[model samples]
Target: MWVCLVVSVALIVARLALRKVRGQKITHGDYWCLCAAVSIVGRLLANHFLLIYGSTRILSAERRIELLKPGFEVQASEIITGSKLVLATRSLLICVLWSLKMAVLDLLARLIMKMPYERKLLYVFWTALFLTYLASIIPVFVGCHPFKKNWQIHPYPGDCVIGNVWLFTYEVSNILTDILLMAVPFSLILSVRIPGMQRLRLLFLFSIGIFLIAVSIMRIVQGHNSRVQSAHTLWASLEILFAVIVAVTPTLYALVRNRHENTTYDKSHLSMGATARTHPGSLAEGDRYAARVWTELNDSASRTDTTSIEGILVERRYETSDVKL
Candidate 1:
């Protein structure tokens, strides 16, 4: 998770630099990616605290007794029990997920053909994401009588929502959002005619949504059956990492493109190879050669500012009108 977060930040910075050098304005997607990065860092902070003071740790007898007291006066600041730890984790994870979602959605809005009818539908989809964010978060606070009661070391079950109900709602909605974000864009991708390889790349990028769903499903399975706190924490962190990865992946491919573009050796050899492979019955090689050259040419074609940032890897306008949507 930490590695993914670091890579995400690095890519965002590099992408922004690329945009600046090209004299393009920073975009909504970029802003959302920045927000996503911040939320991811926030999630990491929550994860660190979970490892140190969350349910996974062994508590002292004295500490346990102190926490269990009726008049102990526990507040949100304290993290003595499992409830507080889980609450904080849930809250932060939801924020991270939604920030990434908005980033991705904004980027897609630019890429997907912008017909008024389609735009209305897209707006509706964006609203759904926002509502999903609310559904995942609002309950974390209000599930208990007093919001602080959620994290308090109550003697027994206080006036809180049933655990089963909370879990089912949160998990189902989360899973639903995960599925929708990935599945809805299929038609849009198919709408724009592109080359086989680029189409494949887009499909692969969209497939990250499937991975997100898989992780979410795994989390549900692990959460339902596992009794170990450590294992639970690990699963939770893994999900967050996957979310960050999906969010950052769109802009990331450009880095690979940039490396090939910047390498004098590769460019020189590519030209030499292109000339050598220009024989009859070498149509396949010609296409491959053309693809590489097109990638380079395409990179130079984008006159607008489109920094690589956004979730679902669905940001950056056309990734130079060819490497992206």
Candidate 2:
């Protein structure tokens, strides 16, 4: 989870920096922001998993009794509550939040870059997928008892008996979602009418998603093992760490690439502080607002033609999200 925390911080800093440069305010499109916040939550969940596991590892019956004393109850209850929160968070983020963000990213690409795809189709598909997964969690929610069991004794009840079936569904769906999301961006980017060599180069770079594929696989293995070991166990902790890193790395790369090139607001093709006049007959207000925001946000994004560096000569069309000044 420490890895997640570190990467989460980096994603936030980078996202904030890029937003500042573009002069764009936060919108739902800023999925990395959500990722960062969710990651911290994931860490909290992971930490609780560790606490419960440690509590279980005490060899002596007397020590176990001592650990469960009234004074320690408060802390133990907190740990159990944290674990439940983690499970809930993991489910919501994996099934709903992250999926929505992916769809939004696709929608943004289509809006900003004229990416061609049935946007409605993609959105509907993802929305359905998310809702189905969320629906599956109802069983777990219904199973949670307020004060029936003695998983741990804090003033409040613990979530020890709640089976991890919900967690398992979340993990499996998350792995699938990661692959689909990673693959979809590449598809959208590659479908653009760019030169073959240029397209190949872009795909090669974006194959970085393959790295995330590896992370997802590892997460599935670790998370599945973690369910039996209490929410605060070590194996579970590793799963959280893996998730944080996976979520943060892409954002970090985008941020680092932006910074290394010293792309500032003024140097971009679209001038900073320029507003796109609202076209009465154009797309919805949300689209127009997003466009205006993006243009302002990327004001300092590297406008330099990267063909020279990538060793591919190609024509470029620089369309940006139009941001109102």
Q: Please provide, for model 1 over 186-286, each residue's C-alpha lDDT reduced to its tens digit, 9 standing for 90 to 100.
A: 65555443456666766787678777778777777766634355666566566666766666576555444444323432332344332333333223432
Q: Which number leads on TM-score? A: 1
- How accurate locally is residue 100 in candidate 1, as Cα lDDT from 0 to 100? 70
- lDDT value, candidate 2, whole model: 0.44
- C-alpha TM-score for every candidate: 0.66, 0.55
TM-score of structure candidate 2: 0.55
How much lDDT does each candidate structure score?
0.55, 0.44
TM-score of 1: 0.66
lDDT at 141, model 2: 57
